[model samples]
Target: MTTKISSVGLLSPGDMGHSVGKVLVHNGMPVHTCLAGRSERSAQLASAAGLTVNASFEELVQQVDLFLSIVPPARATGVAQQIADAVKTTGTTLIYLDCNAISPETTREVGRIVEASGVTFIDGGIIGAPPKVDGAVPRIYVSGPDADQATILNNHGLDVRPIGDVIGHASGVKMCYAALTKGLTALGTELMVAAEAMGLTGSLREEFELSQSAMLEHLEKSVPGMPPKAYRWVGEMEEIAKTFDDVGLTPKMLLGAADMYTLVGQTPLANETPETRTRGKTLQDVVEILNEALPKGK
Candidate 1:
């Protein structure tokens, strides 16, 4: 029989993490997180989501039956190690779910880390936006031998779908899905900035409207919203590149996308949070800003 999940622990609640916490809270699950040494914004988000802040990882691991790691891709491994250490120190045995946008290789490495402490590790990938109160709900696809253990979340307002019993299946799905969605965004940003640099922004916009209206519309919507999230996406792009390279495909395209996100991260606009970013900025505005922020020549 599967163990009953009574409470949940979320690691470092950021935008997406906080929203997921809120949904679990509203569904009658007590959500907790450790805000020790976290940024003020993270604390604020956790408080807003009704998550109880534990003093440290040790305290957190002891209290919750399930733990979710939803950090950026670059930090996923480190976070797993930390949690594993906490689980060891506290003698706590909880289900660990890694929901970051990392490659299958990275996911397996994390699995080894968490599973080493004798905790059940569930590989998970979140697709779509954060869970909204009334809008579309994001799906958390899980895989691994214990993938069915995550189905408890389905009773608590999340759409937890168990895809397979293989550890990397969920992350592989995520890598391929993001490769298309974010890869296209990178392609659009590059051409828009190039157009701006060549002083042909207006002409390019006209041509796009004449022949590539749908693609143009997608760029207009995606690029303007990218700056705030670009920093995290840099690591995600790199992970996607690694995913492609592992399968014998050239990783150059997504590596270039990583570079594009890194450049965007250097822009002043990248400092804004999702809640505080300017709402009226157009794609042209984003392109011009990126063009102006270009370092040195070329």
Candidate 2:
């Protein structure tokens, strides 16, 4: 059944949310929003976009046909439970789309809460920053017991795709890919930071300029994806811990990497912090090696 979405209820709209909500309204979907843990700015932003901002989260859930949970990972499950409980009384088939960065386990838990209350759940993850309000196309990873939800999202100018099986697979892919890509991001940052501290930053920058700069290039483009992604990484790290417990290997190193990424990600230059730090670390490490190789700094 095509759920003709005449109205869209946006919960916890941030920068990405504000932009996307505007896009929805522009696409003929009257957007209503609610602020749970959002600020006055968020409220104002939503109001300017012709969206009706409600006072509480519960109000948002009850009024909207489809609920989009775009909060931090730690808050995703709690919010889902709260909304699911309220919807149980209404006996409405609420289609809840989870677009938070979380583990497969958490996603399954969210599914349990919503599905238990007879609500439709779509396991989904957003992969990029918000696109242009008009003709915006951000890649979305969506999977669930219901395929219709995915189709509905796709038809609405969203780049939505199924992740297969249950909701867990979608979240799992997000967690795994984030760990590796963000891990190296932190590593490069650490190296650059250390090098600059030792006055070898210039040489290292030159080395990167001549040698492998792909890492540097990738870092440059990916930094902005960190702000929205960092808070979620903390939760994914815990999930990685659980994954390690299942296997024989210890997650000591991975855990440390997770910590490192979180620290820089929360900073102002998170967009530039990692790369700047990496430049320093590389110069220092390389300078030391070169000095030793050249017989006591010749």
Candidate 3:
């Protein structure tokens, strides 16, 4: 039997969620979101993306064919619980996809929560940035006993791929990938901030330019855009750390990375969103802020 997906209910349209909702809407699918307590920016994104706003979760669950949960890692399980309770109460059986950066353990926990309510649970992990109409669409890798249900999104402006017939495969991939990418961002921030504290920013940059140019350039490009996102990454880093420890490997590195993101998240710079980020921000500026807030030998 083919799993039919014609209507999608997106939870709280943030930057990434709004973009995903836009692709669904553009593909002729009816996408809806609840805007009850969302920010003004969230409302603007949903409106711009052509997503229908539901007055409440009950209304959203009653109408949609599928539910896509795209949120921060810290809120992933909580959101799943709310959706499961809503579906159980309304007697609505919907396919729920969790597309957050979380550990496999967390993904399976969410699966058990919704599946117990007779809702089909699909573990989904999104890799890459949001989809652009004329550009690339991020790969949404899904896995579970009912993972094939997610293939309904294929040809609808999303690259939907199934990794295996297990709940955590997709989330495992996300955990490992972010452990390296975001972990490197944390590493770079620490190194640069230490250099700034030692009054060696210039000398360090010159040395890295000659010996580690590729890494230095990557840091320069990525660090400036990370502070505003650091708050969300804190939970993601903790999830990654858990993923590692669950498998019997050392998780100290990512645990330290989580601490680094915590510091970044507390800075005034974290208030800037991608739409309202500081103009001409640089890596040096990021280092100076961290150096001032968390000096060496502290």
lDDT of each: 0.91, 0.65, 0.89
Would you estimate the TM-scores of all the predictions? 0.97, 0.78, 0.97
Candidate 2: stretches off by over 4 Å: 1-4, 224-232, 236-254, 265-298
Worst 10 residues of 2 by lDDT: 272-281
Ranking by TM-score: 1, 3, 2
- Let me know the TM-score candidate 2 reaches against the reference structure: 0.78
Q: What is the Cα-based lDDT of residue 162 in candidate 2? A: 84
Best by lDDT: 1
What CA root-mean-square deviation does each model show from the true structure?
Answer: 1.2, 6.6, 1.4
Q: Pick the candidate with the highest TM-score.
A: 1
Q: Across residues 47-104, which tens digit of lDDT does each residue of candidate 2 receive?
A: 7666887776566666777777777677888888878877776555567888777777
- Which stretches in model 3 have alpha-carbon errors above 4 Å? 295-298
Per-residue lDDT for 1-298 in model 1, tens only? 4868999999768989999999999888999999877899999999999999999899999999999999989999999999999999998799999999999999999999999999899999999989975456799999998899999988888999999999999999999999889989989999989998988999999999999999999998988888888999999999999999999999999999999999988888787888887732678888888998877575
Q: What shift in Å separates residue 31 of candidate 1 from its native position after superposition?
A: 0.6
> Model 3, range 1-298, lDDT digits (tens) per residue?
4557789999869978999989988988899889877889999999999999989888898889889999999989988988888888898879999999999999999998988998888999999988877578899999988888888777577889998888899999999999889999999999999889889999999999999999999999989978878898999999999999999999899999999999987787778888888732799888887887874475
